[model samples]
Target: MNFTHPSIRAQIVSILTAWGMPKHLTDITAEIMVETDLMGVDSHGISMLMAYEEMLKLGQLRIAGEPRVVRDFAATALVDGADGLGHPAAAMGMRVAIEKARQFGIGAVGVVNSHHFGAAGYYARMASSAGLIGLVTSSTRGILMVPTRAAEPVLGTNPIAFAAPAGPGHKPVVLDMATTTVAGNKVKVYHLNDKTLPEGWVQDEGGRPVTDSRVAMDYVFKKKEGGITPVGGPEHLGGHKGYGLALMAHILGGTMVGASFSPIRNRTQKPDDPNNIGHFMMAIDPRAYRDMEEYTTDLDAVIDVLHGAAPADPAKPVLLPGEPEEMMREKRLAHGIPMPQSLIDHVRAIAGRAGVAYELKET
Candidate 1:
């Protein structure tokens, strides 16, 4: 099913509102979800509704609370998500950080007691759009990543995102990635699309790679023995570096914010207990260091140099970090976003349960 972006956003808003989410939060979340799809992050877009619906029904995701500041300092702060959806709180945290950066040259904010936020890049872009450098990271509730030489999984995907503006007439540099080799949601994407899991993506109890999509899903989400590898496939291949990066992200995003570590929390908490996820958002003003024209001109020249570099493959040119997403956004806007019929039916089922009208029209 191909749907216009606006239609997708409307359907998301309708279902969220039906589920009793406040209009303002629903609007913010819906826009983020739609933009994630437009940016070609299929794993994090509408597909996430399935997980959210389960959380909603289980009473783990609250629909009534808004984000509130818990602590504030000169250039750093802590935000409470009020045990609600992560989108609004994450958005608020970035906004606050941006404002602080304008005053102090650098700002950092942490969000706690939040549920799964959509693509981190969306929040990073928010800072970039305001002409500041943005850095983002989050701790996950699922224990899907296995550390190097570990027999079982202990870490979540633990994504890290960074974005920086290139002044005018140039796209910002945006890098959003999971410390693990692939995000756990990408496995769900593969399962939904009936695609095979590539080698090195998932491993079994003995650390042998699991290439079968269904088995990989079971290992990552259900059985939970050996799971997704760190960024570098194996210990000999620098997987330890990926493991280190995951810890760094968790330290800043989770521990720093006083959020529960999933592995420890799950041992005592019930199935319906809130995940207590945490997020880190930071912004830095380049103007504090140099003139805007000098910074942007140099950055643009660097980008031009890379763009002019010789490609190893003739068909694939050298592209910047955020170029692919920008290109995808343009393409999706022009052509329409495509989704599997199964996903459409799944969303419709959710709408039925939520008592919302299924009005996602095809483009």
Candidate 2:
């Protein structure tokens, strides 16, 4: 099915409001979800409505809770999300960071006890919009990532994002990605479509390769006997790079925010358990080092050079990290977001349970 951005966001807001979310929160959550779709991040978009609804039903997500200041320093702060949705909590944290950066040239915030934030890029882009360099990282419950030389799942598919201002007519230098080869959300999408996963994404219970989505998830979440591998397939292929990145995210995100780390924080053991996911955000004022315009111009020049680089395969061209996503977002926004029938049904079911009205756009 196809749905316009505004229409989809309105439906999400109304349903969340009916589920007892505050007006402000409903707005922010809806905006975040819609923006995920806008940026071609189907995994974190409206497809997550069912997960949010289930969390609310289990009382794992609080509607009226507000973040509390756990600690504060001159240009840094630690926030406890109080078991609130991550969108609002992260937004609040970034707002504080932005304000501090404006005043002191740099600011950082750490958050714990938060639910899944839609997309890391969304938060970093928020900082870029304010003309400041942005950095974001997050740690979550064990999902589909596997540790090197180990069969069982031990790490979350931790992700990091960074964004900075750019020259005129160019989008910000935004890069967002998971340390793992793929995220659990992408696995969920494959499962919904009844498709097998590509090799290297997951392994069977005994550390053998597997392609069945259902079996892969069972190994990762249920049996806990096997899991998704790091970006590099095995020990020799730079898999350690992805491992190092995941560990860095844990330290910066989980440890810094006083949340559980690695095995201790796996939420799959207790699906309804309140998530103590942690996040880190930093904002830097562009004027701190050099002229803002010159910096942006240099950034644009570098991007242009990278774009013109020769490709190993003539059929494919060299591309910058954020360029393809920028083009996809523009196309999807104009054409309408494509959603599967099952996801549409999921949203309708939620609306019915919440006593909210909804209408789907024709495909």
Candidate 3:
């Protein structure tokens, strides 16, 4: 199925409104979700709506509360999400970071008591749009990563995102990645689409890699015995680097914000326990280091050399960090966003349940 981006965003906003989220928050969240899909990130886009809504139903996400700043300083602050959706909290945090950087040249915000904030790059892009460098990371209550050689799971996917401006006449450079072979939620996406699992993505209880997506998904999300491997593959494949990055994300995103580590959270525990996820967002003004013209020219030159470099295959050109997504956005906007029939069905089911009209038109 295919649908225009605007149509998808509107439907999402309507359903979220029906679900009791404020219009302002839902509007922001809807744009982020649509932008994620526009970038061809099926694993993190509208495919996630039902799961987030479930968080609200289960009381893990506050349905009626708004995010509020709990503490403030010169260029750093703490934002209490009031146990609400992470989108609004994270967006607010980035906005504040941008504001602070305008004054102090650097700013950081920690958002606590929040739920999933879709697409970390969105917040980073916010800073880039303001002509500043940005960095963002988040903690998760769910755990699915296996250490270098350990069979047990201890860390969450824990993404890291950074973005920098190229000044005028060029796009920003943004990089966002999970510190695992794949994000934990992505296993669910593959499972829903009945796709085959890529090798080196998941591991069994004894640290043996699992190649069956369904089986691997169950092991990681339900059984909780087996898990996904860290960013690199096993220890031989530089998995330790991924393990180290995940822990660093936990420290910056969770520990610094007073959220518990995955091991202590015990996400599977009874209700009334919140995921208590946290996030860190930072903005740095490049003008503080050098003149905008000097910085922009250097950055553009570097980008040109990289793009001009030879590629292994002529059909595939060397791309910058955000080039692929930017290309995808252009293509998707010209045509329409594509989705598996199963995903279309899933989203429609959610809309039906929420009593909101499904505005997508199937091809």
Q: How does model 1 score by TM-score?
A: 0.98
- Model 1 lDDT vs. the true structure? 0.91
For 1-363, candidate 1 gives per-residue lDDT tens digits of 688999899889999998888999999999999999999999999999999998887888887679999999989999999889999999999999999999999999999999899899999999999999999999998898888878889999999999989967789999999989999989988888788998999999998999888788899886757789999775756688778888998999999998889889988987678899999999999999998789889998998899999999999999999889999999999989999877888989998998888888787
Error of 3 at 221 (Å): 1.4
User: Cα deviation of 230 in candidate 1 (Å)?
Assistant: 0.6
lDDT winner between 1 and 3, please give it.
1
Question: What C-alpha lDDT, on a 0 to 100 scale, does residue 73 get in candidate 3?
Answer: 95
Q: How many angstroms is residue 98 displaced in model 1 relative to the true structure, after the best TM-score fit?
A: 0.1
TM-scores for all candidates: the values are: 0.98, 0.93, 0.96
Candidate number with the higher TM-score (2 or 3) = 3
The lDDT values for all models are 0.91, 0.82, 0.86
Candidate 3: which stretches are off by over 4 Å? 267-269
Candidate 3, residues 97-124: lDDT per residue as tens digits?
9999999999999999888888899899
